[model samples]
Target: MISVLNLNVQHRGAMSGVLTLGSLDPAFEGAPAVDGPVQLDLRAVDFVEPAGLCGLAALLELLTQRTEHVSLALSGRNVAAYLERMDFFRLFGGRVEVHPDVSSLEERERHNPGTLQELINFHTEEEIPRIINRISEILKGKEYLLRERVAICSTLSEICANAAEHGTSSFGAFAAVQAYNHIVSGSRRAGEEVIISIADGGPGIRETLARNPQYKDHTETDNEAIRHALEMGVSSTGELGRGGGLTLVAQISARSGGSLSIRSGAGRVTVYRDRKNSRNVPPFPGTFVRVSLPRHAAEDRP
Candidate 1:
């Protein structure tokens, strides 16, 4: 029998959720590699951001490859409904089994085409704008300022482009966006916040960076690698006029009072409100990036 893996709900809302998912790698690694089913318990999970779902999908993808079967036990009615609305079952389909077996995957897919579009995998460069345009529409619906939308889209475009060019994954890269109502702490006003997550199962940042002769001497730990990658003008390709994607994302996060978190290999970095923190955590197989952008008025643009 496989031990049940419990996911934390408090961390299931944004960048924190991606880290929470990364922390599970060790547990899964320690679990016995039996042919029987492994259970993922999501009973305590109350909130799940798009980043969380993408992380979960990546974890499930890894688990499905290693184990013979995998099952999910959802906590409550609300969580079940949330999963249904997100079309989680349809995405995984036969790869993951839901306990108590609610709706057929085919039925869910047929009814929830719109939600499925929010979580997508892209392989070509042309598909990047389609994802960006969809996210722009969602942000526009929330009344975010045009400048803010442009900044967010620019950051997203860079990150997605990086994934396509460097991720080197046969399965391609995954991008997901989730918008939800959140309270702005000091203002005490409810506003819409959107989280954008892009992940790929490929050689992580450290391995990629080591390819450059200049960076070869850096002796980067995973955290250090992520930090270096975010530095302006740093590129694994050793090319000039190229390599500011992550730096732009960081600037957007700092200026807008948002947050950016990236996990590659065993290192994790979070930048929020102009402060940056880095640490070594459980190793994630590939690269996972989540950017949280809160609603900002037109005048708030920097």
Candidate 2:
């Protein structure tokens, strides 16, 4: 019998029917020994964010390793079209069988100005500079202030660099960035926002930090490791001036009145300007980062 794994899109909540990084089920993360066909059912999904898109890509990479026949069941025209715009099918379309044909959506895909950077897969640190230069050029054509552009690009490069350095995997890494006209998923407030996300299939934060004996206490739990990672000068390598990239990225987001969230293993943490919140979540096989940067409207800006 074919095994069916539901994407578990939330039914009711602030993120109802929306797939985010945390929406992924832990079952798939643990049961990678499958020898039979597997179907990822996402028909109930209505929307997806940058985090969700990258997470989904990472999950598919993991599933493809265990089984030959992988089917993706998707519903909703809007969601399908959005995925097409983000080049999801271009990356994985040929890899999986789609229940309902989405070829039409792919054909109709048009340039989305809000898509600062569509989902991209990179294998090494060398690939990141090109990605950064491309996104920087895109930002230049937009109305973003110089500082705003720097913050977004810096946040992206820092996380992408971290993923390339510590989270290297056979599948490499995935990154995406999008600007929304209004606050859609994370918060209830009204304002324009930019969401940047990156995910890599490397060893999780806990295992990476555990590599260094000094982090034994901090690596006791996934949450502890993630929280410890946010601190300046914390990394698997005990070298000076290293491991401060993520710290600087967090500062950039906080200064913009935005937040940065990181997830790996079973821990997820979100950091804001004034405080930080940490929680235990479903196990994510890789390190995932999401940054939210709010864009104040011209009328509201001083």
Candidate 3:
């Protein structure tokens, strides 16, 4: 649990315990107090999103609470972005220290996307297959097994296609396609992370899924609709879903050690946290399902 590390805090091997990246220097107190600055190697780190940033801010406050003087260093592209956000900056109050840039956070964010993100306002039902195929192809050439690759591809296709078919049908196909295409064009905006939010003007998932005769109007059960969808032979698509798709998706996720999230009506949101995030997830009103899994690791697990 105790060892010297660079600024970035790479484990250099498999880790056991949870590593807390508090805003303050975790080791400033116990160290011998070296004269020269400690070069924290943060190159291995990616960005922490708004949610994750909240956790980091909480840790910083905890440090302030527990200790007297904890030196603060803002390095890495991601750490800087969190600091830049108005919402995140509120964690440290109005007067936040604008430190010198250790790495070009802006430049790095330009090319590499972090694990979990939302691609709001870009994708449509008609083009769903194309994106799923593209991601599958990316996974195909990787070091993962062929079966795992196929599983990820299929699960993504089902979740997204269902989201589009059911969620966007009310908006007319052409308009939906145009709206989604716009999202693809502008993947990067100054203050926005690309996220896809698909909302349907039709009946919500609760109203729709419970209509299935097999469900027997059991709306009160915990995660009933979602669980039924994950059951072996439940299909909301009627003829389109010959048997079970979401079940397959859930099984694949469970086998791969990934996560799946579902939000129905207005009061329900279920998030299945995989180790990381993937390119697919249903986000918005109606029935929204988002699957955030790594392209390869999902297959590498079990």
Candidate 4:
């Protein structure tokens, strides 16, 4: 019989999902010796954000690299459909079987193969424009000024490129975008918001930055690492004008009334307008960056 492992529902997204993955090491302590399929029980998981979905994909990809067989047992029809929409099944490449056969599996065939919702490997330069164009399309009717859109796209490119260059993971990096309405005090706002998250299953920010000789004397916890990483000139490369990406991103976020949050190692940092906060949490593998942009109101409506 195959051993069944239950995926934690509480830690289903963002940094929590990464932690949940880290907690599964014991389940696969001797995975290569197992001859039968390893069942991943996903019945308890009802919701997952795009970042969380990517994290799970990265985890499964790692497991498959170590073992021969892995299967997914979805808990319910809704969860199955959710996974389908997120294209989670594609990661296994026909290796894993679903408990209940998904009916709309063929619908994926109709989707454009170039769609940006598809996971992007950090190695490709061509994928960056597709991602930026997709985000541009999402904001087309939202009346963002051209300069604002440029800033957002540039920030995205820089962040994703950084992931590709510094992540140092065999699994690479993944990014996804989602747009939704923002509600406050039981009321919906006039503007919509887009959330874009990028993640990589590599060493966390603190570990990566510690390689720089200049930072050797600087003692940094996870939270401090995140903060320092965003400063204008701080970078592991230790070169002049090398570390302005996150700083520029932070400036754009503040100017546009958007928000940015980053989680790496055991710390999480959030910046909203003029305010910034950091906290300690369960340590997560690698780094995750989430950027949220609100619709611009100052632009002329077309």
lDDT of 1 by residue, 1-302 (tens): 66576654455334342334554554445443545568887655665667777777777877777686788876556656666676676677667888766674335443533322456877778889999888888778777779978977887787888788765766568888776666332232455456788988788899989988888755359888888888888888878867787888777766656778999988889987747899877667689998767764445434
Query: What TM-score number comes out for model 4?
Result: 0.76
**TM-score of each candidate?**
0.84, 0.90, 0.45, 0.76
Candidate with the larger lDDT of 1 and 3: 1
Query: What 10-residue stretch in candidate 3 is worst by lDDT?
Result: 172-181
The number of clashing residue pairs in each candidate reads 1, 0, 21, 1
Kindly indicate the candidate among 3 and 4 with the higher lDDT. Answer: 4
| Residue 43 lDDT (model 3) | 38
Best-first order by TM-score: 2, 1, 4, 3
Q: Over the stretch 243-266, how does candidate 4's per-residue lDDT look in tens digits?
A: 877888778766656777887877
Provide the global lDDT of candidate 1 against the true structure: 0.71
Q: What CA root-mean-square deviation does each model show from the true structure? A: 3.8, 2.3, 14.8, 5.2
> In angstroms, what RMSD does candidate 2 have relative to the true structure?
2.3
Model 3 misplaced stretches (Cα beyond 4 Å): 1-123, 169-202, 266-284, 292-302
lDDT of 4: 0.66
